[model samples]
Target: MTKDPTLKPYQLRQLMCNSAQDICSKGYDEESGWGIVDLHGAMEQLEANYGEQLPFNDVAMDAYYVNAVNWALKNGITGGSTSTTFSPDMTCTRGQTVTFLWRAMGCPEPRISANPFADVVENDYFCKAVLWAVERGVTSGTSDTTFSPNAVCSEVQIITFLWRGLNCPDALGRSELAAGLGEHYYTDAVAWADTNGFFSVTQSSFNPMGEGIRAKIVTYLYQSLGRRQL
Candidate 1:
């Protein structure tokens, strides 16, 4: 089996800082990572807070995982590839990403009938969702009529989508959100993202245009849902 890399305390702190910043800039609430109640943190808290009295077991853990999975599934944010697994660790594809956001936006189910992308066939599950997002300016393909449906989504890319999906609400914009976030091109998007508490930057000089990872994504989503640390 492959062993996971062991990070030094300082390195782990840096990673958490980066993760927190990234998510906060995207409109999530900024909070200290040490005591933040993210999904993993929530699970650990459950174990610590109720383990002595509750019948916690693998079954319970499975139940919690399934609860999140079912919620996402019902909202069209996720779908089963097998009988009982969500494959949560798998990298999300662009199509899946768009679908997830669409569902997160209350599954608007747009009325459009045709997809702008030739590659996205009419019968494809993500066709309408992709079109809806594109038409609403929530996203644009890598090129005209070519919505790389199978491509794995990047963290920055997901943040951009989330920012737009929220209609660029009055949270923060790039210029005022953080300094040294790469070039000036993404300033507006970054500012909107920042004010909304989607992402954060530590050291007061970190770049905001960098890539995001799965942990950051999950954290941001959990925060966006206003989950508490019980």
Candidate 2:
């Protein structure tokens, strides 16, 4: 599926046979460390399953991005940047991105703590999201004492954050991961994110410092959801 970006989906039953065989052998272990399951294969399955169900009327997303947007909306992870428009190209704030992830994860409450950052008010919409990230080691503040919640999050930073939240899934099995941008600070995270379909095909550069937008971040989250399906 990685080699064929314009590919359509295969039936789920087609995947079940081999997967069931592996499960039978491995006793249904979720992290069996089996052979590399095609990340594209998982996405194609999801697209086939839910591509036509998108209810948003104003989103201008291309075909590749629609499924991810649909999945995010269907799961109540986002309500669009505006009432009707998704504004896919607009940069996402750290607070907004974290809150979107927190919502997608069922809005678990973090342990009570004193508000550590001066900017994050108790009743702010993303207050709990920031706190949860801190508590879970998903993020540390920009400085030792402050979380610039309104600041824009970068591609590499967000991917690394998501990777950490997922306990940093191994990157060795995927080809793109193994051939990542050499020795940059976000080398490993960019590798994992790329192979896992975090970045869209149009984005050729790793561009770790590039702007992380709402649509792209949601797509990464949606693709990560596919990994859980495996």
Candidate 3:
């Protein structure tokens, strides 16, 4: 491409965002502001961070989670529901979230010998993920004998999983949207996630018990990766 090539509106938006990430506060969310930038910086930083566009039948070019899906695909975190479909709106399961996080962390081997949950068989797909999560304090199963991997994951559940995956860091601050939050095990996790811009579906309110669909889960994982400095 030429140095002074023109860009469409969506292309321009992506370029500007990726460029802002180049100069913004370290691991800070977008509300921190983009600071000052020029077309030169934007040009140089184009696609350097977000990577090239991907081919997903279910994901749109301008969807908020496009970057997340693309990044997840590139990093071997997911391969979509099929060769050309992502099934972004599918309800995410506890097993799927654990698997995604496990893959994002490079599919490391768990440090345990015996399987704790009868439901999480060694031959199952999420068995290793459950084990790895257990070793890291990310989860302790749904019960003494059941991992309940098939359970539908809620927004609070996924956020708590991610928070625990990061060793439960203290929130530097809380979002104003967190004012009326009810007392629950996930209250602190939601606060931390809100502070870091995890829940992108709504800014005015949060449904703590809402279903954690696939799109939201991937976006949260992507944002978590950014907070981890890549």
Candidate 4:
């Protein structure tokens, strides 16, 4: 198109006005430089792209545990402590902890081995998991022949068990761990767990003998899986 050589001021103004109007389309206005803003439309489009959003009522959406809980759910690591409640604050027993790791590892059958522990009955749910752990050198027992299945496992014990289950990978350095975990048998395990992302960096002074809750244990297991992509 060519401009008229003798275009009048009024005509020129009209042309300019039309040109400016052409810059905007249906969904925006002059202020927005397109058409009208359609927030509802945008939201609907997003829902369509991402699928319908479902709410897990019991899990706190903004809590630090929400991500780990959700990841565990998605990966079949757990279905929560109950259908709707995770019982995050509840302390996990030794049997439950082993079972969690066993389940996460795909519940492999243990090689033929004698069940030396009297407390771990053959008919119990955790029996096979415990035997599997023992056969793989993941755990020994509470004692020579007593697997304290009901006892609350310590953080160090749990981390050590997991480390053994993962084939005992080398941890890089441990000057801080040595200082904090004086004479603690599971110090190396804690260092390994921390180095492999099982424990966060802020946990410098680890209470190795302290009881770990369900939420924290599951979070540790989930993070450990992330390190090796299991």
Quote model 1's TM-score: 0.55
Q: Candidate 2, after superposition: displacement of residue 230 in Å?
A: 6.0
Q: Of models 1 and 2, which has the larger lDDT?
A: 2
lDDT of candidate 2 over 1-230, digit per residue (tens) = 44335433422322331233342223223345323465556565555654354555656556556766776776677877666677777898899888887775557688968778888998999999889888878887888778999899998878877877766777744556536556765677777776665555435555767998877788787666555644
lDDT of 3 by residue, 72-170 (tens): 876678888988889988898889889988876657688896897988888888999999998989888888888899899987888899889877888
lDDT of 1: 0.52
The candidate scoring highest on TM-score is: 3
* Model 3 TM-score on a 0 to 1 scale: 0.75
Question: Which ranking of candidates, highest TM-score first?
Answer: 3, 2, 4, 1
Worst 10 residues of 2 by lDDT: 10-19
Per-residue lDDT of 123-195 in model 1, one digit per residue for the tens?
8888877987887777888897799988877656766676676565544333454454645534555665566
Best-fitting candidate, scored by lDDT: 3
- The Cα error of candidate 4 at residue 76, in Å, is 3.5
Indicate whether candidate 1 or candidate 3 has the larger TM-score: 3
> Each model's C-alpha lDDT?
0.52, 0.67, 0.74, 0.65
TM-score pick, better of 2 and 3: 3
RMSD of each: 12.0, 7.4, 7.4, 19.8
